[model samples]
Target: MNEDTARLSLKIERLEALLAVTKAMVTQHDLDKLLDIIAHEAANIVGAERASIFLVTSDRRALTSKIAIGMEETGLAFSIDAGIAGYVARTGEVIVSDDPYGDERFNPRIDEETGFKTFNLATVPMYGTDEKKPGPLGVFEVLNKKDGDFSEEDLEILLALSGQAAVAIENARLLAELRLAQDKLDRENTRLRQRFLKEYAFENIIGIAPAMTELLSLASRVAESTANILITGESGTGKDLLARAIHGRSPRAEGPFVALNCAALPESLLEAELFGIEKGVATGVEERDGKIAQAAGGTLFLDEIGDMSLATQSKVLRVLQEREFTRVGGSETVRVDIRVIAATNKDLKAEIEAERFREDLFYRLDVVELCLPSLRERREDIPLLAEHFLEVYRLKSEKDIKGMSQEAHDVLVSYTWPGNVRELQNEIERAVALAKPGETIGQEILSEKVRAAAPSPLRPMADAVRALETGLIARALKESEGNKAAAAKLLGLSREGLRKKMARYEIKL
Candidate 1:
């Protein structure tokens, strides 16, 4: 073929290759795949043995190659002003070098690390559409052309390809960022759901008050130990519930949790109940294990432990001290591996002074004492507990109650909860049961006892009592026909004292 025809055919083939690569670049959105395709196509179209696409980092301090054909691996990086690609990326200029080893801009470390020799290489800056500034995106390079050094035609084709490469790279980068953000959102949503289930579980015990938060923190810490625990609080303060929470948080959560109320049974029955019963020990009684045996490898919670008789306390002390006990009639010694959590509303110290409780037993069970605050002490938690109970009973009763009214919340927070959380829960449950569908709980739905405990007007008690006295005295005078002497007699005050009393009470008569 003639030189003119051969050159024309070569130009046509180069144009077709450019068109095909541009289509391929736009179609592939995956950044890595696009980079690989771009690198290989640039090398093949330029008749070179190696090629690489290096993007400028966000900081613009370095260039990073995501794909480098003929290299052992990719992710090669170099300073933006140090190497040939770096110079092109920094200065936004096309660079062609036949003696790359002699060029001062060439970096030899990359060639040494990758074990590749470059006889000639052409580098062109990839720029975005914005021409107001440098607008350079990266450096695209083809190294060691097979037939001869890269010509001006090859440089022009690469420059055009660099423009298309810039846009495709930017789109792929944006898509990668969006995917990362979506994955983070999905992980956060999953974490929140798990946290809700854990914190809102019936056995988890919910409280936002600082005191309650601290108390639960202590409970979790203590749960790691096998020490005996004494939980002290007023009746209805949920000591039993807290004990269960400790058990659930402990390592023995999968084991049995045996609960027994010391006061629920009589002294004789309590001892037999605690120490188990052998067959024939009682009339028609079969062999049975007590709470201690049933709680082996787990936790045993003794509720109302203060109510237990001294004799029973002695037996309990023996078990705690020796870790061994025998049934009521059996001679076989039964040893147990268990944690004991004892709870009571009564003050054992006072009981000891009264000679009603065993001091030794009290010491045995008081290894770790966790005193639960009364509801009145942690009044800030009332609203939270109320809402929790509201949701609980709403679900239980299949009601549509969504929340509690402000007035209802006021009533709850103002009331002195003598019975503590147990009373609050019951109050909220009753309110939820009585509340209309889709209606919030209101003060009217609360039980009379809670409503009656609402605080009176904020005033000094002395002033309020004096006001009452004045009203009573004035009423007596009106009934006594405004006769001070008659009113004084009715009030059981001397006539002389009557004048002083009337003056103090501010009575007209």
Candidate 2:
């Protein structure tokens, strides 16, 4: 073959490779993967020493290098109007510099910083029809294009690549939105589950906090078994959810999961509720099975078991110990096979010490004691719970709420949610139903009680938050004497979360 023909054949082969790369890029719906693919392929297709793709920040005033290929230290960052690439991004035009040093707009500071010499550069704006101030959709730049200066054919190829990159970027954004919507739906389902649990709530037992994660795990482990279980928590937490989750996961899932607030019923009637009455038994005319019989082949959740009157307590104690109970006024014995789960917000140990709750009965029911952490302990779960409730109310109310504003997230993450998850759920639902659609539920959305407790920090908010975060981590580390795990715990952060913040703030210790 002739030399020209040989060269033409090689060019055709490279074009085919480029086409494949473009197809692969299009197939990527994730922005990060698409960016790296585009950056790598751009370098190979243009035969440049390096290629990088940058996304414009929301402020439209900075270019952040998201992907970099074959570039030392992997980036060229610039302000919106600062350098050649920045000018292209700022002006919506191609910027070509034959010699990096000679061009007025060529800022070789990145080369200086990375210790790489930039001989040539070709920067082009990826424009979109957004019609706002009209800026680059994104910016791609290459260093030292091979086979002479970047020609019209090279620009055409770059333009085609730009279109593909934009498509991938837009698709990635859409996918993110879809994922968010799906997450919202999942949270709504959780809210419905919470509602089911509410029907079974009693004596204001609070087991809704994540510290209850341990309790939940334990409950699920023993839920299907016939062993009696106890739910332990401070008063007013939702132990009902734990009971329901256990029942829902159990072998007797289809059977009734009956509940009674032992504290609320009269001692005389409590006996009637637990043991069945015959048709002619006493003044109560109806022949009905008691809670134990009603909960046959299922779970029976008893709330405030510690508060049962001594007389009634002895009867329950007998049923629990012997698997049998007689009706209040009838002599016939009723036998039931049941999974018993009991909750008491009172400190059972103290109750036992005070002799308010029977020691033997406590031990019998305490076969599995699930201690749910109060809201003060698992404060980290608050933001997650808040988001869950927000999603729920938004969907049910058919509001255009996108998500929590950064301010709302900050407030949520900071507050000590005294009322636990239930309180937070109530707050969010109220806000979603009350706030105007398409607007964030701000501090205004919160109850007056919570609003008053929030920090009255002054604004034009001092550039203090970033500095404060950094200072707190540093202080904790110093207090821990550089033990990172302890420092993270002191700051109420997980190890990974702490590491990320430390890296972000450049806090070495």
Candidate 3:
């Protein structure tokens, strides 16, 4: 071939080789492996003895070798302002050095350490797509050209290789970051699932009273079934908690547990929230799935179902009956497979008699009814629940509180918690906040209403008298600072008589 034709042939060969490098890079996702491939290809294409690709550190303070060819050890690093490679990285220029040792910009320490002689070398800057990087990503360097000193053709080849290598490096980094983020998200999701299961376990409900025990036994039995359930109780009586425990124990434990309060939204909005809305259903409203769709293959907890409007109740009834629903302003009939667990603080029977709630909807939801006892009805569980809350709040607040004083326990047990178990939980949390570190929660830290609560006059005479006597004795002890003689004097009784009464009432200081 003539000189010009030979040159054209070489150029075409180089171009084809670079195309192969690009194709190889596209398939390689591992950052370390990709860098090794790029370095090997660059050296082969340019007939170099060895090659190295250095990358800018995250802090942009230095460059470290990502792939070093013909070297037993890798990760050779130096300041970004130091060598010929640094110069190309800083200036975004290609450098061809026939005598690298003679070049002022070349650092010979690397040669001394590795015991490798460098006759000639070519360095090219690698540019990346990140605008945040103030300079080139790093430098691509090839050492000791085999035939002679590195040539202009060799520099051009290195430049093309560097460009492709830069893109490949960026893609590898992005892929690595995405995998890390996904791994972190997966760990977080697993942690949340574990926490959810622990929180809603049936044994963690904190009720041991006979009323609660019977209720829990029955609830646990029905939890495995697919029947719709209605939970009726006063507000804060743990209806929501029981529903969650049921879901966590059921066959749908792996599925979602979606909750919506029927009283929280108006009729139109509640209907849309339950059944979802179509795209362009209203101006600026995007299409979205509702709670029903979200609860597919899971459980839907409808809190305060008695408060749902009759119009919405009728739609919910259709869903329970036909196992399908249509989104508002949409014609698509969406089918669902979800267990419905509805709760209400209101008396649905009374509401039905008053012609407010639909009787048929009530019947559908009430397939299995579970009535949670009010906190007062299960007062024997108070101390256990209080201690549970104490430990929880102590850890949360990082306090050193040990337990509740007998006076505090008596007050908690005596008080009729109108807000039920939720109120007791809040009360304990409050007492914990007000209590001093290393001290027991005292009646003094309790809310004034709790401190001064007396038995209702409607209680049986003996029970009412016993509660009154207990309150008076507790107050006397508090006034006298646990001095039995002074407390008895204040209460018009001998110290021995007071001790006997204290024994009978199980009162401890």
Candidate 4:
């Protein structure tokens, strides 16, 4: 063949090889495998003995090898401004070195560690398709051309290959990020659905006492309103549960319900948790949306709000007053449309008098106050609550327990439940675990504290007096046909005093 024809045929062959490598790279989705393919093909296309692909780390401080051909180990890292690859990454320039040992920018430690001798090499920078990523994504380097020193034709081929590899790498990265975002969204949706199920609705709050009836009636009336709410109750009185029920019944039920415990974190961390933080606010701190931002168009439930530091209260007051806030270490004002619900076991009035809580913040959150009755004051609801819990635990444990015995029920009703409804729930769960299948829960399985509180024949003077007083009141009420005034007159006691005794002993006519 003529010399000119031979050169033209060689050009055609190189173009065909490049075309095949590009097609293979575009089809590979797995990042690690695609990088290996790129490294392998770069060497084959340039007739090189080995090749390596080094990607810049997220911090932009260094370049780490993702795939290194002819090496037993990969992931070798060096400063981004240290070696020949680093120079190409920083300057976005290509390097063609016939004698790497003589180049000042080439580091010889890699050679000493890998024990690989290099005669000629070509290194090119790979740019990302993302506009946000302005700099080169990484460096693509091939070592020791087999035929001769790497020529201009070899540099051109490596550049084309590197460009294709860069596009493929960016595509794979974007796909991974999209999948992660989709997974997070799906998980959030599942959590919201589980929280607002029919079982947790406002109508399902197990209660029948006058106090509970009144509370529920007021709550239902206010559920559709946009007014802020403050729930006050002792610990274990179902404050969080009530807050969720209110959200479920509100017009914003379709939006997210985000909660935060004001007492769970320190003052510094609490500020960041409630208001979020800017990226680079501290070492290794990434940007994120706070609970208030997450609860936009729905509700933000702050539990134990009385325990919030005075400084945090001031910032929270701003959010309540202006409906906007600035993130920690950030100046941008972010506005949100959300309802606020604050709950605490502490007396906010006392906290305000003690100069610990902000009065303005309290008034903002207390637009509609709902103070839950302690289990002691609502004794009439004990049997219903216990039965509800029994059914729940029975199904949860897969036990065949039918019901509680009368003696056990009486003991549960007599006990002064300092821990309130939560204690009763735990007790029922424990009894179900200990009871045999198809058997009723008896007093013998009750907790020692509860059983000890039961009325006994051989009791102390106080217990004997209370038991006698309870029996007399029950008899008087029955004789009077459930008339409190007539019962009090027959027992020689004022009506209010007699009513108090009845409540204390849980006496029913």
Candidate 5:
């Protein structure tokens, strides 16, 4: 063939090859594998034996290979500025050599390592569209051009391929980083969930008020016993905290503390979650030991026991009576030595009267009983709880927020906390996290949903006591009708008790 005719045929073939590389890149965009392929393919298209892709790293001084082909089995990384590839990556341009030995860009060290002599060579920068300052996605090179030396046509093809290669490489890198970030976020969310369960309900049992003190003392006493303990309280009154605290203090503290909220899960789910199931025992073949078995020698805190379905309540009653249960899907009877600490924010006596709760189960669990007080009943404990939550949020948020000021403390002390300790804790936590650095929490820090917007401090005891004393004296006189003995009944006091209070307040009626 003549020189022009041969050259025309070669150009068509090169275009086809370039199309093949571009098609292959679309099908497979995995960075490491693609780099290896691009290195070898670029070499083949240019009529060369070996090629390497060197990428610009975070520190822009040097270019490093994501991978190298036609070298040894060992992984290799080299610089673009130090060698021909390095020089191209640093300058963001192409470097070509007709005679590698004659060119300053050629490094003899790589030739020594690969045991392959490089003759005519060319390097082009792979530029990513994602970057502001375009760094090298890779360095595309041809080791030896065929039929004497490479031409401007070969260089154009390489540059065109380099542009496509840069986008593909950048896309792959972004995808990998995105996946890594997603995995990290998922792991962190899981950790936060675990920590929430560990700390929020179980760790926080707030207040030292008389009502709370009695409840905690009873819980501690009951923790020494293996009997089924029943707890009743208002919703959000820390019933579960009492149960978990008993479990945490019990002999089973070292064992698993498997707790289930009966109100949280439906009957079918709760049953499966509580009981063991065998592999292939039903559809979706896998075996799972129930929460009862999971608790084994530990304590199983059954929260919101009133919400348990009748059928589940019957099964639970049997477990209390017989200390055994069958798995939801398996018939084998399993006996668990779990210390049952049950809690409800509902009154079982009322539930039983309403025929919603079983009498037998109530009595069985009622072997030991404790009741937590509502936050309104413990107004004096609010300041302590608020401060506690402040410290907790301060550490959790990694902030420098100081504690609530004296005015804030007084407001917390006297305001009727309708949402209870948990609400107070959340309020303080929110306030502390939102507070500016070195700022003390004020009334503004509080959630207006709690105390009305622009909340004022509580009414002083001095301002309130006069009305309180007058009401008591009037009630005493109304009930007694000038006799203290009968008035004591209406006043919920002994005659002597009534007299002492009346004298203290200096009531005249």
Candidate 6:
């Protein structure tokens, strides 16, 4: 072949060799294996006798070699200030020397320790991704070129290999770090799930009051059956918690327990959301099974059932009466074998009288009625609930708080919790977030409204007429545990009239 053709052939072979080296390096994921591959490839590409890959230690004070081909020992560490490789790393410069003994920067200690003789070598700095001012990642060095001395071409080829090596090293390191982070996150999620199960277990329901005891006993008895249940209580009462408890204790404990609030969805979408939908039912709709189908062999909890529209209620009544439902815009009668547990804060009896709700639906749903006492009615359980919530939030916030102080306990018990158990839970969470480390939550951290809530004083009568009205209302609400209907009846006023008076008096629920 002519000189030009021969030169072209050599260039093509070199490019192919470089491509092979890159592909090999990319295939390796293990850091030690990749480093060894990079070292061996660098030596082979440059026609060198041996090669070593050195990485900067985390402290940046030394270079550590985990992989060194053509060496007695694989692991080697040296100070960055000591040897020829160290000099290249520190200065981020390439070094090509025909005689290593002639160089002042060449340290003979490693050679003596390994019982290997040092000769001609080319050292190249492996740089990180930042091009503006590249940082030294490590050093790649090869010793004793096979043909003769280390040449300029050998240095250039080694430099190209070292660049690929640098990127592969960074990628391997990042992948290892991500795996470790994911493992940590997985462990934390498992811990949280176990903690939730332990905290909300049936035995740990917290209330020791006679009323709470009776309610729980009834719930436990009914949990074994497939009978439809209707849970009645004021807003924020633990009706949802009771529903979950029943599901957890049932024969289908291993199955899913799906819950949907009836008041949360619009009337137009409620039917499809509960009973599944067919394609072409509306714009952008997909064929899918809904909550009823999803809750098969499990429990389906319908919360705030009183807020469901008359049309939606009629559909639900059919589900209960006939054990089947038809999806919106479809005639297919889908049958579900789910245990139904419905809850409502509104008086369904009162609703039926006003023609806003159906009487027949009420009879179908009230097969086994369970009434949860409001928070005020069960005031004796406040301290227990507070302690439980404090523990929950303390773990969440990663704080060392022990429990509530005496003043804090007093504030919690005295406040008329119109929002019931849920409101108390929110207050405790807020207190934990604001609490100092290693300290108990105090009344100082409570909301201003809760802090200012005080019982009427005996000597106070700024306006006897207004004072009597407010006092009587507040007393009745406190006695009834914030049950407005009961409080209204006790005061001989309609529910709507009592609501207006409570609003005018700034009585919050």
Q: Considering every candidate listed, which one attains the maximal TM-score?
A: 3
Model 5 misplacement above 4 A: 1-206, 453-509
Question: In every candidate, how many clashes are there?
Answer: 0, 6, 0, 0, 5, 0
What is candidate 1's lDDT per residue for 334-388, written digit by digit as tens? Answer: 9998889999999999999999999999998999998988988888888888888
Candidate 6 steric clashes:
0
TM-score of each: 0.54, 0.48, 0.74, 0.57, 0.50, 0.58
In the range 115-181, model 4's lDDT, one tens digit per residue, is 8888878999999878887589999999999998998888887888788778887888889999999
Which scores higher on TM-score, 1 or 6? 6
Better of 1 and 4 by lDDT: 4
lDDT of 2 by residue, 1-509 (tens): 69889779757855775677577865655677777776776777778888877778878888878777776564556787777878788777887778879888877778778887888878877765556746677887888887788776667667767767766776777788898999998798677656655543332233355555665656667876767789878764567777777777677765678998898888878878878676776664888888989998888899888788767777888888888888867887778777788998888789878878888888888998877777668766667677777887888999998677766766665676777667778878887877887787787677677776666677553457777898899899999999999999999999999999888878884
Compared with the true structure, all predictions reach lDDT values of 0.84, 0.76, 0.90, 0.89, 0.77, 0.85
- How do the residues 43-158 of candidate 3 rate in per-residue lDDT, one tens digit apiece? 88788989999888887778898899878668698988888987877788888888887889999989988999999998989999889778899899999989988888888888
Query: Which stretches in model 1 have alpha-carbon errors above 4 Å?
Result: 1-203, 455-509
Q: How far is candidate 3 from the true structure (C-alpha RMSD, Å)?
A: 11.2
| Candidate 5 C-alpha lDDT tens digits along 1-509 | 59999889878877887787787788886777766666666767767666666667776765665655666633456654577777777777777777788877678887787787887887888888866766665677777766678778778878887776787777887899999999999898777645644664433666678987777777777787788888887777777667767776677765767888999998888888878677887778688898899989888889899999889999998888898999877878888788888888887899999999999989998998887788889877877777777888898888888667876776666666666777777778788867998888887676666545334447989868767866976777886787878777777788898788788778756
> Which structure among the candidates has the greatest lDDT?
3
Question: Considering TM-score, which of the candidate structures 3 and 4 is the better prediction for this target?
Answer: 3
Positional deviation of residue 362's Cα in model 6 after best superposition, in angstroms: 11
Q: If both were scored by TM-score, which would come out higher, candidate 1 or candidate 2? A: 1
Worst 10 residues of 4 by lDDT: 191-200
Please write out the lDDT profile of model 6 over residues 143-255, one tens digit for every residue: 88888887776777788878888888888887988999999988986776456446555787878989999999999888888788999999988998888888877887656
